[model samples]
Target chain A: MTRVYLDNNATTIVDPKVYDVMSPFFCQMYGNPNSLHSFGSETHPALRTAMNQLYKGLNASDDDDIIVTSCATESNNWVLKAVYFDKILNGDKNHIIISEVEHPAIYSTCKWLETLGVKVTYLPVNHDGIVEAHTVKDFITDKTALVSIMWANNETGAIFPIKEIAQICKEKNVLFHTDGVQAVGKIKVDVQDVEVDFLSFSAHKFHGPKGVGGLYIKNSQELSALLHGGEHMGGRRSGTLNVAGIVGMGLAMELANDAIEYENKEVRRLRDKLEDALLQIPKTFVVTSRDKRTPNTMLISIKGVEGEAMLWDLNKAGIAASTGSACASEDLEANPVLMAVGADKELAHTAIRLSLSRFTTEDEIDYTIDVFKKAVIRLREISGSYAE
Target chain B: MAKNDLIGGSIWEEYSNKVAELMNNPKHRGRFTQEEADSKGFKLIVADFGAESCGDAVRLYWLVNPNGDIIENAKYESFGCGTAIASSDMMVELCIGKSVDEAVKITNLDVEMALRDSPDIPAVPPQKMHCSVMAYDVIKKAASLYKGVDMASFEQEIIVCECARVSLSTIKEVIRLNDLKTVEDITNYTKAGAFCKSCIKPGGHEDREYYLVDILRETREEMEKDKLLQNANTVFGGGTVAFNDMTIVQKIKAIESIIDENIRPMLVMDGGNIEILDVKDSGSHTDVYIRYLGACSGCASSSTGTLFAIENVLKAKLDNALRVFPV
Candidate 1:
């Protein structure tokens, strides 16, 4: 059976072109970029080229503006911790403002910092999972060190008003960081246009190899390093550079930049069809705002049925999807993102996220709609909560 | 489907094939009606159990023979995740054809073991083990309803780990049977302290009546005592000394003399010395209070690593129940 994978928000398959560009670096062109030799010289230029590509892709001011890291989790952690520690060293700021629906990389780090006497304010989202700019403005004070929010939510796919929030931070003279992991490839993200002090994104979310990601820091901003070792990546991030992974990420971003227009048009059309067909089922409704969310994502709740049971049925039918954030699925906790939007416990528990990608075909979307409708019907029948 | 294609590859593979089969197509899943019970000439008993943490609930039904203790039929309806449905189905299957008395004897372990594809492997992940426990608790509820007795009376032992539904006897048995060394080992074997971790020790996210740490310590002490008693004639100098018979002053003098003769030289060579403060005797146990002087007073190991070393010598020389505490 052909598998219809719709969990793109979790991770995407590496593009074959990206893989082809990365292959030569694995064995043939492999060298320590830091080592001073012919082999090192050959690899060092390749690293610079990949860095330049990412720099142009993000519309960064220069190559130094991009700091490549292992994953978005690391990049997010680096930004949060670097800002917190820098303020601590200078004895200037103590407070941080972040949205409640942030990925665990930001939320969990903030929570841990709170235990260490750092004051953190979690801004709540509206019914549509959008964090209003005024809510962020109200929380900003002179003591606030940074305002970190994600550009797009992984679970709900709701696009936050990052530009407006950045403007508020600029007016307040406070640093702003956005986890642009979901938005960078799917949407046209220009760092200069948004004017965010820092931004983070991973490669795997946009058809690149896993384990390679980048963080964008605006020029003239100074932040401490998370990992300190031999001088590498311009002393901003220190470790051995993943040359092949970096090449894959650079090529992936180039391809994503080329296909963004096509993805927005075709993917959105297919996603809307899937959403409309699924809503035809009784007691089903889209959870996220239709206008403010990513074009390739839809979060829907089928009442009286558990998401895990439904996903299991979908899996049996060769359709892959997710209940909420893949990271929090093991604990089986109700999605906090849905709850932040004022969804009741049952609604939160019943939410299923289906995210598409550039590769998602029209046939795949129709099959998913058919299989998902049947799964919901069968699950509701067995759930003992549905009336005949 | 290929095993790797599942939700989480290796982690989901921990679930037995039977559990997956039963989750997809559960047997005895619907409600057992009163009409069916009347047709079979059996009395029906219904019991409900719910987990407050996850909001998962299970309702069990038993049709018992009116003339005897045999269960004519068993069925269940679970209002939770796939694991709960699978567990309830297995629970009902295990109850059928068994006498009511025998049905009560089937434990959560039996329900879990029946779902295991192999004897050594666990049927489900540690977090999902509670579902089987929910199945086990409902059987007791049904049996109590049928027998006209309180559900609490059916519990033969106290439960130490509520998340894993591990009884004190089972914990002790696992500890003794495997010669388990630590609380982590208990979790590895029985999944006792795996989830929520309130059962591992005090000051966790939740509160519990008994803790796995306390159980392991007490069980280890009991096992130690048994070992000491088993070799009572061979251990120590000639035979074990009854330190309980001595007065507090005598116990202090005995400990100080041993320290002076054997332990003091070793400490002095390391630029440290030990001094006895007091000795107190509690029933079945003795507490020796001591103070460290010189380098040992400020040393990090003096409180823990060295204290254990001191306690070991005291246990070997004194009584098995003697506990040494730094003053």
Candidate 2:
């Protein structure tokens, strides 16, 4: 079967160049960075090289500390829990602000912090699913410890005004954090330009290996270590370094950043072609316009067709796609991101997301469009609501 | 890049061959209209049931033999996941050639088991188990509309797990028979407390009178007591005698019946009547939301005297889990 993967937002395949770079670190020079032996010191140059690549890719300065963690989930938990201990516990500030449509890494962590008496203000999104910078200014209070928001929504791919929000936080003297998991490699992510105190990103989203991600800490802020034992990552994070994953992530970051222009032009053109073709089907509407969302993403809802039903047909045709709703859960919840975008209950269930990467070709896009349109027609014919 | 390294897990792989087959080409996918039923001298019964949140709905069309109450033909139109399409197809297949009562007796587990590619395996993933449950609920909806009775009447036993439709008696019996000790064990055997888990204890989707925690505890104590008695006398009784015993659903039916017999007429005599909107399990209490019709809509005694009067009547006759509210 001709497999056409358009589910880039979920994760990505490792680039061949990235895989090649990561291979040598696995069997050879596979030493603990903490060890002082020759085996360990042999890996020091590679680690420094990888770290430098990450800093340059993110446009983070030398003064900023970039700590490599397992994934963005850890980066999120470390930042939030660290704030809870540093400020919230000392009664310096007990309130935090975050956009309601944050990924579960940020959303669920805030929910857990709520049990610890940390007051969380989940800033509501507009109909466009964008958290307005002015609204962030309105919700900020004297006791506000941090304001964290997503750079781009995972479902709709709606890019938020992260730089504007960061500026507001700076003026208010409050720290700013952005979950840059979807934004870093997908878009132009400059920690200097955005002026975000903490930015979390993952490697696998940009065709790097999994189990490796990084946190960009501006000025190496006073935050508690999430893991305590080894003095690795300058004691900010404690664990034996995943040498291969780090190497792969660094190269992937560089490659992904280099393809930002190609992604904006070529990938976006393919994405728009797929989106426009899908719109030709009846009762189909895009969640965000091409200009509003990321270049390589298209979230559309087909009237009266359940998301997973459409996915099944697409899957059988060897086209990979994703839905906004939790299709796997028994308690079927409408996609909160879609819901925030002012989609109705039915539209929320019908939402399907197709995200492209630099590797996506025009031929694959055309094949997916053909398969998806047919799936919609087939599913709608059998749909109870649309049978008439 | 290696192809394996690029690709993530496929959600479609979680489904069985039977499920994918049915989902793609379901025999019972079409609907039966009244015209078709009239030509065959059968009653056309159409039923629709929507999930509270998932937006998944199933519409069942039944061509029933009015004389024998046998479903001459059954068809359905569903809007849900792939598993839902397969489960609905299997549900309608189970209904054909069976009496209405027999179809109503078909549980969600039966629907799931019927869709299995092999007898020992499951047709769908654990997450899609609720699709089978949706199939069962729609059956009750169709059966209730056809029988001209409350849908609650079709429910006989105390349903501990609404997701799996595993009843209290069945859970207890399974606990004893399989020597299931923990809540997880009961979940494995009967699938009770597996999904949603409102019936397992308080602070879930809903509160249940018979929680798995209390059921496991009480059934264990009774088992110990029965063991002592068995040691005293070297004879043992067979199991599953009262596994069919009705508890909460039977109590609900009883409560509704009492209100119909004792309370409705009295309120009607006062130029007013009451309609039961819903009876939900909230913690240890069963909250009944009602709407007073005619003169009882804004009656002076509706809050103080009449409300308590209805609550007292249901509580006095039925279980104390009943709490009456005029909505």
Query: What are the lDDT figures for the candidates, one per model?
Result: 0.83, 0.85
For all predicted structures, in order, the TM-scores are 0.78, 0.79
Q: Write the per-residue lDDT of candidate 1 for residues A47-143, one digit (tens) a residue.
A: 7778778988988886337888999999999998888888854668999999988999999999998987889999999888899999999999989
**Model 1 accuracy (lDDT, Cα):** 0.83
Location of the lowest summed lDDT over 10 successive residues in candidate 1 chain B: B232-241
RMSD of each: 9.6, 16.4
DockQ of each: 0.13, 0.24
Residue-level lDDT of model 1, residues B102-170, one tens digit each, is 999888888989999999988887666666777888999999999899999988779877656678899
Shift in Å, residue A194, candidate 2 = 1.3
**Candidate 1: which stretches are off by over 4 Å?**
A44-49, A325-332, B1-9, B51-55, B147-149, B162-165, B168-191, B194-198, B201-327
Tens digit of per-residue lDDT, candidate 2, span B1-327:
278538644556767888889999988987887789999999999999874246578899999999899998999888888888898999999999999999999988898888878898877765567677779989999999999999988888778787778888899899899888899889888877775566777654334577899999999999988865654343113222121232445445556777898899999999999888877777677788889999999999999899999999887766666788888
Compared with the true structure, what per-residue lDDT tens digits does model 2 show for residues A1-388?
8999989999999999999998988888898877899888888887788998999999999999999999999999999999999989975899999998999999999999999999999999898878899999999999999999999999889999999999999999999999999998888999998899999999999999999999999998888999998788888898899999998898899999999999888888888888888898877788766788899888888888888788888889998888866466533457777787777676768888899999999899888887887887787767757646
The docking quality of candidate 1, as DockQ, is 0.13
